[model samples]
Each structure stands twice: as C-alpha cells, then as structure tokens.
Target: MKVIRIAAALLIGPDGRTLLVRKRGTQAFMQPGGKIDAGESAAVALVRELNEELGLIVDPTEAQFLGEFSAIAANEPGFEVNCQLYRLDVAQDVMPAAEIEEVVWVDAGGTDELHLAPLTRDSILPLYRSLQSA
Candidate 1:
C-alpha cells in the first residue's frame, strides 16, 4: 500500500469550532491541508496550504505541533495517509479557494452529520475532543 505524507491543520475559531474542508468533487471532508513538498518542513507546508486552499495567512511559528497520525486514505483506495498535524487558533475570516470547494466549522458533537476522511473521523477528531477535555 502507498502512503501519502501530508501536513494538516486543526484550525479552531474563536467560537471553538474546528474547520474542515472538502475538495472539489470529493465527498469526504477532511482537514484543510495538503501534501508536503520536497525539502519543506511540515509547518511550512501547512502554512502554504492554508493560504492556497482557504485564503488564510498563517505564520509557521503560530501553529502548535500535534504529532503524527496514520489512517486509511479518505479518498484513495488501498492507500494510507501519514499526517503531521498541527493546531492553530485563528480569528480571521477565510474563503474557500484552490481545490477546496466547501468549508465548515464543526463542533465536537456535530461531526456525525457529515462524511469525514478516515484520518479525521478515526484519529484527528477523537484526539481533538480528548485535548478539549484536558
């Protein structure tokens, strides 16, 4: 099986909701991030992906590293995604751009209504909720 290396952000708004994005023509909504480029750090890749996909400017220094996670690929069959995830608190407005077709800010109790990526559904969300209670 192929493993795709990616950096993702769990962007929390002032109201405590985290942002999730769905790519164009894709049904699974995942974190707003993409694959890391060669020679780029995960934090830097997340900064770039935030600007490109959500029109949000982020400084690499402002993001908190949340460690790595791996799960079955959300949109890819027989593949896995290995993600270096970060948590960022933001107050700025964001607009969907690039390949991102829709964006939603969801609270912990509200995820069951939407189709989520395996990483988000199985790993990230659970981790987020755990952190929230700590």
Candidate 2:
C-alpha cells in the first residue's frame, strides 16, 4: 500500500465555522492545505497551500499545530493519506481559487452536511468540535 503524506489546516472563523474546499471535479470537501513539498517545512507547505487553494495569506506564527492523522483517501482507491493538522484563526471572507471549485464555511454541528475526507471526518472534525466548545 502506498501512503501519501499531506499537511492540512483547520481554518476557523470568528463565526466558529471551519473553512473547507471542494477541489475541481471532486464531490467531497477537504481542508485547505496539500502535500508537503520536498525540502520544505510543514509550516511553509501549509502557508503555500493556503495561498494556492484559498488565496489567503496566513502568518506562520498564527498557526497552531493540532496533530497528525492517517486515513484512506476519499477520492482515491487503495491509497492512504497521512496528514499533519493545524488550526488557524482567520477572517471569514475568503475567495478560494486554484484548483478549488467551491468553498464552504461549516459550523461544527453541521459537519455531517458537508462531505468530508476521511481524515477530516474522523480526526479533524473532532478537533473542530473541541475548539468550538473551548
């Protein structure tokens, strides 16, 4: 089995909704970040991914490390993904571009309404819930 490693962000807004993006030609919504680049730090990859996926510039100092998780890829078969999660607070108004088809701000209670990646549904959502209650 091949494992894919990625770095992702759990961007939270003042409204307490989490930012999610639907990639082009994909039905499920996922976190804003993407694969970690060779010779790049996780934080750097995350910052670059945020800008690429959502057109938002995030200050690295503002991002908090959540943890690492692994799950089966939502859109791929026989492939697994390991992701390092981080949470950041940002403005609610954002324009998603690059390969993202649509962006949604979903409340923690409404996670079920959004089709999320396995890692997101299993791990990230729980963290989001905890943050909401904190």
Candidate 3:
C-alpha cells in the first residue's frame, strides 16, 4: 500500500470544539494541515499549511507535538496517510482559502453524520476523547 505522509493540526478552540475542514470536492472533513515538504519539519509544514488553507498564522513553536498516526485515506482507496499530528490552543477565526471549500468547528462526536478521514475517525478522535476524559 502506498502511504502519503502529512503533518496535521488538531486545532481546538476555547470552546472545546476542534476545527475540521473539507477540501473542495472531497466529502471527508479532516484535520487542517497538509503534506510535509522535503527538508521541512512537521511543525514547519503545519505552519505553512495553516497559512495556505485557513489563512491563519501559527508560529511553528506554538504547536504542541502530539505524535504520529496512520489510517486509510478517506478519499483515496489504496493510499494511506501517515500523519505527524500536533495540537494548538487557538481561536483565530478561519475562512476557507486555497483548496478549502468549507469549514466546521465541531466536537469530536459531533461529526458522525459527516464523512471523516480515517485518520480523524480512527486515531485522532480517540486521542481527543482521551484528552477530554482526563
């Protein structure tokens, strides 16, 4: 199976809702970051993705490293995504830019009706739930 490595951000608001974005023409709503470029740390890639996708400015240092996760790609049948995940406590309002067609800030369990990328539905949501219960 082919794997696409990406750096993703679990951006949480002061209200405890996490930010999820849907790419144009894609049904799955996943975390906000994007592919990691060669020679770039995951944090740096996240910073660039945040700016490009959400029009938000995030310093690389502000990202709290979460860990790595893997799940089947929501949109690609044979590809998997290996994600380097990070969390940031931020409330900056986001607008869809670049390839993003829409945005939603919802609780972990709130997206059941929406198609979620495997990384978000599998690994990331469990981690978020664990944090909430703690």
Enumerate clash totals for all models, in the order shown: 0, 0, 0
Question: For model 2, how does the per-residue alpha-carbon lDDT over 1-134 read when each residue is reduced to its tens digit?
Answer: 78877889999888778888899999888888998989987888999999888888998878899998999998888999888888999984778788889988898788667788888888888888887899
Indicate the residue-level lDDT of 54 in model 3.
Answer: 91
Q: 42, model 3: CA deviation in Å?
A: 0.5
Better of 1 and 2 by TM-score: 1
Model 1, stretches more than 4 Å misplaced?
A: none
Q: lDDT per model, in order?
A: 0.94, 0.86, 0.91
User: Each model's TM-score?
Assistant: 0.97, 0.94, 0.96
lDDT of 2: 0.86
- Find the 10 residues in a row with the least total lDDT in model 2: 108-117
| Model 1 agreement with the true structure over 19-47: per-residue lDDT tens digits | 99999999999999999999999999999
Where is model 3 more than 4 Å wrong at Cα? none
TM-score, ranked from best to worst:
1, 3, 2
In candidate 3 the C-alpha lDDT for residue 72 amounts to 90
Better of 1 and 3 by TM-score: 1
Candidate 1 backbone clash number = 0
